[model samples]
Target chain A: MAVAADGRAAVAQTAVAAESRAVSSNEIIAEFVDVHRHYKMGDNVVRALNGVSMKVSKGDYLTIMGRSGSGKSTMLNLLGCLDRPTRGEYRVGGRDVSKLDDDALSNVRGHEIGFIFQSFNLIPQLTVLENLEVPLFYQGRVGAESREKAEYLADRVGLGQRLAHKPLELSGGQQQRVAIARALMNDPLFLLADEATGNLDSNTEAEILDLFDDLRPDGVTIVMVTHNPTVAQRADRTLWLKDGEVEKLVTNADRADAAPTEESL
Target chain B: MIRDTWRIVRLGLKSLMLHKLRSALTTAGILFGVASVIAMLAVGEGAKQDALERFQDMGVTNLIARSKKPAETATSNSQSLWSALSYGLLYAEADLIQASLPTSVVARVREAKRPMIRGEHFHTSIIVGTEPSFLELTNMQVREGRWLGDIDDRRLANVCVLGATLTRLLFPLENPMDQTVLIGDDDRYRVVGVLSEQGRTAGAGSTPYDECMFIPLHTHQRRFGDVNTTRSGGSFSRERVELAEVKVKMPSSEDVAAGAQVIRDLLAQRIEETGDVLVTVPLELLKQEEESKRMFNIVLAVIASISLLVGGIGIMNVMLATVTERTREIGIRRALGAKKKHVVQQFLVEAGVLSALGGVVGVTLGVGLPFLITTWFAQKTIILPQHVMLAFSISAAVGVVFGLYPAWRAANMDPVEALRHE
Candidate 1:
């Protein structure tokens, strides 16, 4: 199955049919095949993820939805190169991410993915513009260029007027905007948001969700984790995670026409 | 890395500024430790230097022979008495040594009492009768007129030299040069010169050189009988007047030991008698002073080092707290491609800056403390040597050694976990 006309290249010896596939190509951006993740609590070991496998294609927006402790966050961490799977191969853009050292993993994270946390993990001491400059500093840009890029990003995020304000001084919605701007500074290939709007009210969450919706037209790939169906409904596709494995995936079409409510599902 | 260091330094200083009271208290520890080191070492070094200066003033290589007696019968009280009775150097003994040894100058003193007067002022003084060479041998200087001549000693002229202070006291307004001052009952001696005043010896109580009067030895023997007494086979007999104080001068002070040895050998051959003489060497005292100076420096260094240790410990404690406080910051830098060495260097710079600042403070306090102490207590001013600076530099090095571990700990923190921390 050639996923031609797509930006990614995928090579698999065996392929399984995924239901309601809307992607025109079989291009693979990430592959977590037969991955297992475990944790130890005192004497007994508990499995956080059990034999879970998934793939994402180029320019694909994904949503991994689950309740607390369903391994959604753990999967996100693995996808972001923050943690390693206990078993099986994990690949990001066809590179074996599982084999990288701590330094290399950090480099991979810095270069390959941009992370947005729920609490807007902007360094509180820095201003909105400085927060955007942080990743640029890590990327080894000089002061003037980094500043110019940060200012441009701040303007793009609609935070030009509030660049001098600290994260603590900003509203929750504004703070998240700063985080998103910071994430985009290095022009990372993948954007991973873990409950990015969890701390915000519905109005702020809706605003941030609209911002995520706005990013799609630019062809930047995104993956977000959310428990709320309303929030997940904004994504092009949603993967329902149960007990650390992918239970089902739903397309926006299935969600729009006669979507299953909580009781019906 | 340089930019990172600058950023860290700016951050550190800002943090310090945020906690003003805490920073002050920590800096105070460094200040006191440095100040105490400078002050203590300065005092000790000053005392050692004072001793050496005094020793050098006394002449490093001169040999002095004070009268001494046989050890067996000499109790502490009786030693002086026995030594006085021994009264070692006879005039002939000095002449014999002078002829036998290749020494520079031999000064012979024959003691006699003479009552001298100028107008109505009469005072009994120890009239030291000696040769013309005595002036050089004793290291005495003439303040006015001239020293007694060879002709005066040979002809036994009735003339005397007054010490500077005595001359001042006797002749208040009028000049004493070429004036007659009576010696004994009928003889009137001309005061040809005044000797320069030498300060009082700590060993010789209240006996300053200014109180003495000098006359020809042959003239002294003609007037007063003799002061030398000797014993042979338990029988007391009058001996030709002995040399009261025999001062032997060499070409250099370093030759004093060899000169003493030669003098002893020459005396042994001429005397033909045992247990009759004693030799006391001031050069031995000089050696003892040198040894004491070494011991003094060691003690000073030990005391100074204690304060330096305290300073180093203070730096370590500050660095440890800094490491703990900046754990997350360390994680961020490490994640941003900082090597372990880079992280270590950031913290080491902080500590190095601290100790280097402390060193500057130490040097300032070390320099100022001496003058301050002198003025406050009205004591002698202290002199600090170049080696004190060397010790302070070592203290800064100690700061670096002690501070390294905490910096390493901060540098080695796990980035992922640190980022996860609230």
Candidate 2:
């Protein structure tokens, strides 16, 4: 928390440190161009995010890693459409969203971005299937068709038999699976996970990551924010943030065909 | 839209069901409020109905003038003791009143207390002297035999009609028809008719002819005379009263007021002198009763509304607490794409469902409470449809109205802060 307060002056120098390094022809689904988010805390202005740029493309898996003061949470909030950048621009599906009003931003969140939280934030009052229906419900798409879709997603997460169970009744891993199924309800452009395995045991975290891996062939895009290096290394590429700015971008060396260029395909 | 509302309402119900005891206690507040409202109004309506029945029994178009023995008559005539003080409605006044209301029926009545005896059955009661028109004016019908006719009055025959209750008191077992009752000393009047039972409550001036004996007007005048002598514990008194009461029946209900005014004007001079003749107009009393009833209903509504307001406040209190407790849930919903209005609607619908449930049960209890009152308390109760509707709608509106502040607070909470709420 104190690092975040002291990092305000370092934002300017680190802002120019990193940029997208993927040499692929995949279509861009979402992009952030030099985004800055500033808040005036009493007498001090806290620069949470300063001049950071990144891109998420179709069929790609990327992770954002930073210390507590490195704007990891802010990046998650921005990616989820829960907060807008104070300067620069955020685009989803090639349209600028930072200037949209609350309702319109909420519409973008419902239709484009899917979020998975560290706490597996499924509404406890709702059953697994009902939790899966939340995203579509906001779009007024609840009916037999949505219910069928929910059943299909629940089965995909291996929770078909637990559709009627409340989130509180499920284990941390099972609850996170429900959250994942819920995210897929809208067929979002990409999944934005904020420390998705922060509350899980090692065994469950590996299982959930494998579930993410299984969706890769289906052209599912993902953007994750985590502070754990082991979790970050599982992604195709890792973007590091320091002092509210991207510090470096590293492509995992062990992953074969790390960049799926058109020529390689 | 209706389907959407119904869906929201169903969801609200499920959420409320999670805290069953809390919801039930909140509902009790409204239940009792609605119950008391219906019950109180019912009691008021019942009292009004009772009064209405009394006035209706007295006959709306009829004006009664009863003879009262003036206090002055007692003071002045005490010197003589036996001079037979003359007071009350004079036979002359009856004639004048008959002439003025030419289209009306005037039944003049005279009362003579006498000991009448039949086969081993003897009692002392008032023997009423009246014409044939008395039956029609009093709304009394003959159950058996025949009522006295004009010929019986002209001949001064000793024929009488026994009141339904008096027949039981005097005759007991034997049929009163063709029987004879001996009045005073050697004055025998045959019972020629029996009146149907009149379930009227006797009012002031000793009315309700059910306990009286009806005889020919001339027979009473010829045999008993105008003077009534009484000797109580060696104290002697004699009073002369030509008529006991005069009932004037108007052509219709609308004519009662004008007819009463004409009669009042005619007797104005005599009333000032003796103050013994009191005229009773029932129509004016009925109108006054109507006005007072409206005031009573208004009072009842105000009282009922206050109770419902208290109930509404109870709902508001519960909803505010529920919103505070569900802050994290609101944040989760907002993160999952729920808008501010959605959060507000969710809580508002929950409150509405709570109160509407109370209304349903409240109506059931309110409707049944009157029957219990009639059975256990023996109090008359009338349940009005509009009252039920008013109470139910008000209860529902109370939920929505009281829920506004809490729902707005929930909707306006900062999502970022709420998400971090433990």
Candidate 3:
């Protein structure tokens, strides 16, 4: 039964890829063209990423999956604008971010991409409300509008009453929720989450995944990097990386078929 | 930008609040530094003002030619007792000084120590023989009756002006004016005037003017003669001195140095046997004192700066530890879109606020310490507003200077590496 569902998901993924190619360039939120990332360790040049090309459209929920040395970390760093590709073009919101300087890259990171860590990296010193205002504070837009937006995002994440509480005072799942609210505070082009649910228990993981699922249809783009197949199965599409190369592109149908019990839950 | 700065500063303050004891200890370094700076400056200022007052009391434009007993030479030992060693300012020298410095006002003074008697009330005090111009030159005022005029001096009238202290001792209840006071055993003088009360610090010479009695020069010359004798340890010493002091007031301060030089040259030629004349220019002493005071103030400032240096080192030490402890927090802020400059600004603001708080407390303590010193220890101290501002500014500057290294280290961290740190 799983094999039959996998065959259906393969056919659905080919169709979705064709449909994405038919969409206009303006609809693409981020695009990586023939990107390469190399690091020098002592005397050896380690090729982290080589000539990989992909596109993410607006409102797309995509996931990148790989093992330890497969360069998924490099992909997340590049996508979040925290780093630049060595010799390729990385465009976010129609601007080439790969050629930008540190300050400009910081600007893109502040206004365009929101990040969530596996540890739920909320500033321990700040309250949940202050954590949500971090990105807007960097953009020098911290005023009534930012406060109102932070309040609305807090309510949306079901943490409205806990706005004044610190991150250390909250549970792991609750901290992750606050991180999610902080990621959406700037209304960025996409949310880049690295191992978003790796630290949570089974039940809390399901809840966070359900929250991601609820946000997907609302036209909020999310790009997540993780090693767990179960977590990757929730996204609209999955990109599998192996030895600095794209191994496979899995679609929603394939993920749903591979884990029917989880999909049903 | 201002609102953003306020947010960052508030964030810095919040982070500093995490380690309350550490923060307070670090603040204490700056506190003592600022307080010491202010206190030292106040002491230096007080000393300078005291010196200025003493110099002003001596008449800044006046040159004094005083008589001094020459050291006994081998030939002076051959002189017999009662012959009286005549080594001092003479009436002839005074006339020559008046002739040489025509643009100056010269006042001659003959002083003697004698026991004054009013009935049975006897008090030993200085008796000063001076002309009428002496009152105007010394800036003295008469409280009752009238001062001696030229007619009283020419007629050789036996009238005297009693000092404030002497009047109280002699008259007690009745007015001292028109009273008779006996000098030595037989000489009697009528009191024509009483001097007003001058404060303790008003008299800068050997004898306070408030405790002396003034008599006309002719009357003193006729009654007491030009010789004074004293017996000590079974040995009799006598001095034939005509004038004890000659005070010359120059027309302008610019002429004082030249006039003093001219008087010294004139005395050097006349008194060939020994250097019996002592010439002192108050204006020169005032200049030398002012120069030394400036040096003293500079030394005090240097010492104060060293304390600030030590305080800055303390701040640096605390900030370095904070940076090490908050490596992960810096990584989080960097990930949340804080630039390197933003990280630097946040840490610098934290340091600045810590030192500024210390400076405020230190200024309060610094200003209060002088009052305590003045009240309890009887030491004069003056706290100028500029001194407080200077000390506070230096402390804040020390914070920034010392905080630079740690802030730079924080801003230069690799975000991935920092986040990975435990």
- Number of the top candidate by TM-score? 3
Tens-digit per-residue lDDT, A1-265, candidate 2: 3332332223222222211322344768789999999988999989999999988887789999988999988888888888889998998877899899878877888887788889988887888888888887778878766777777677778887898999999999999999998887777778999899999999999999999999777567889999888888789888888999988878775554556221110
TM per candidate: 0.74, 0.88, 0.92
Ranked candidates, highest TM-score first: 3, 2, 1
lDDT of 3 by residue, A199-245 (tens): 99999999999999887655678999999888987887888889898
Predictions in order: chain A TM-score: 0.84, 0.87, 0.86
| Span of ten consecutive residues with least summed lDDT in model 1 chain B | B200-209
Candidate 3 residues lying further than 4 Å off, grouped into runs, are A1-26, A254-265, B200-205, B269-273
Candidate 1 residue-wise lDDT, A1-265, digit = tens: 1222121111011011221222454457678888888888999987888888877776677789988889887787788777788887788767888878766876777666777888777766666776677665655664755666666657657787888897889999999998887777666656888888999999999998888778765556788888887887777678878898878877766535756433212
Those runs of model 2 whose alpha carbons end farther than 4 Å from true positions after fitting are A1-26, A254-265, B1-6, B71-78, B202-204, B269-274
- lDDT per residue for candidate 1 within B59-143, as digits (tens), equals 5554444333333443424544334334456667767667755656776766655567899877766677778977766567898
Best by lDDT: 3
So what's the TM-score on candidate 1? 0.74
Positional deviation of B374 in candidate 1, in angstroms? Answer: 3.0
True A-B contacts kept by model 1: 0.10
* Model 1 DockQ (Cα-based): 0.16
Minimal lDDT window, size 10, model 2 chain B: B202-211
